[model samples]
Target: MIVTEIEEFSEIRVRARAYLCFLLQRYIPNYVPEPSLDNIINALKILKKELPQAEAFYILDKKGMQIIDAISNNSEYRRGKGINRSMRAYYYRAVREKRCILTDPYPSLLSHNLTVTASYPVYDDNKQLAFIICVDISLKDLLKLFHPSSIDSYFGHFTKISYSFFSLALLIVAILLLMKGVGSFFIMAFELRHINIKEIFESTILITLSLAIFDLVKTLFEEEVLGRHKKREASDIHKTMIRFLGSIVIALSIEALMLVFKFAIIDPQKIMFAVYLIGAVTLLLFGLSFYLKSISNIKEEE
Candidate 1:
């Protein structure tokens, strides 16, 4: 469950960071004249009113020491005073970047759950660092705030269930095709003296198609249901499409070859039909090549 939440967070991390930075810059002044802890706390309280999803808010002095207790609706997160936060990523990152930044999700001591920290560096009127304002929000709460289609939501669960049923059905079909293809091969193997070339080609086609469908099922299950990331070299959807089409092209080519051989042996006049089928297969191969080239160009542009 935590892994899933992290995956979802990564998907929306850029948007979350931008929104948090915008909010912090809008509510908290970039530079104040001798700002006090009470003034920062009041600003955080107002910010919390605007964003009820935040778990905790705390102010850290320029040296990365908590100046006062945290302000949070939950009591557990309200006792963070006198803590040394200089070693934390949020504290150091704010000092390094000199701007508002959002930290990656990590386990929170107060909530015992994965939480992200948004840190905003405050400066004094004389251009010296004054303090940093930090807010903590659970990954689940942040997802709910920004992404309505998160896996924990109703629509997301429904989509996962639908994909599961479709994948199961496709998997069963692949298994049946594999079984039939294997049986055909075994039967052909036993009767080697009276071998049928057409039967061999048919079995090969069945196996090829079955393997393509199985690949499709695996990709769909992993990407849609498990939220796994695909390799950057190619998109999963495009790769699946290419594999399925390539299988069909191979099966058609085999059929055309079988027809040419059969017609040349039995009825030479009917070989022209095999010629037409070969032409169609050639056209399909060309189309698939074009599709690949187009996607490659798009990736390069990106």
Candidate 2:
């Protein structure tokens, strides 16, 4: 959630900065009052039309006193006039650096709602600071502009919810498998009144399968629901695969070992099957090792 918020904020800031720069370059001195107050108000009107999310537009002189309030509402403009904003971070940063800046979301004094301020510094003919243009945007409107598509947002939310339910279902199945394994072992022990080698081998196989299911559930929950193993980088993908596949390799090796013992003592004729299982396990381990080595080499090259 934090990562998502950061990403959204970054996108909003970048867009606001670019748009402010465009406005400054194209609609200059007119907005600087060198042309006329009418020109400045017209420029502000054009900006408001282009960016509907912009709640208000104001031009502040180098002294940080409101020079012109071009907001649609006259009463609101009158109320905002002559306000000093020299101490505000957004105003100070833009004037000091002579650049455009987008401030983090802050509560608006008038509306008491979250707002982001985009400030652009205007320069006079001598390249001295002339005026600072400010645009007030609400956080809700900023998000709408950032996302743009309602369908994408809804689909993304649905995907997260579905993944959560899928992880929960896998967890329930794992628990049931574990219970089945334990119940089978108890039933056999009580009925036979003896712990025979064959019965022990069967119980072990059941328990191993239950364990494998549990491992899969854990991996799914961590990767999908908790997001503990997100694949952002090549190394992240490699680590996730290693953890998930390592469990499977261990389970397969155990099953193969059990098969070998069963064939050697109870059924010698089935020894070839055990040999084949061992060969498969060996090949899997070799492939996994090669993949890990390749990942390490790639990281070194980087």
TM-score of every candidate: 0.78, 0.72
lDDT over C-alpha atoms for residue 121 of model 2? 78
Residue pairs of candidate 2 with colliding backbone atoms = none
Model 2 alpha-carbon miss at residue 98, Å: 1.7
- For model 1, the stretches where C-alpha displacement exceeds 4 angstroms are 1-14, 143-158, 187-197, 235-242, 260-273, 289-302
- Show where candidate 2 strays beyond 4 Å: 11-16, 23-38, 67-81, 104-115, 138-144, 147-152, 185-192, 196-239, 265-267, 294-302
- Cα-based RMSD of the predictions, in order? 3.9, 4.6
User: Candidate 2, residues 9-82: lDDT per residue as tens digits?
Assistant: 56567776676668755775523335444566677778777777677888888889887644743345335778
Tell me, by lDDT, which candidate is best: 1
Q: Against the unseen true structure, what C-alpha lDDT does each candidate score?
A: 0.88, 0.70
lDDT per residue as tens, model 1, 1-302:
66777877888899999999898888787777886767678888999898889999998999999988889988877898999999999999999999888999998988988899999999988879999999999998898877788776777788889999999999999999999999999998899999999899889988988998998899889877885642223676788889989988998998999999999999999999999999999999999999999999999999
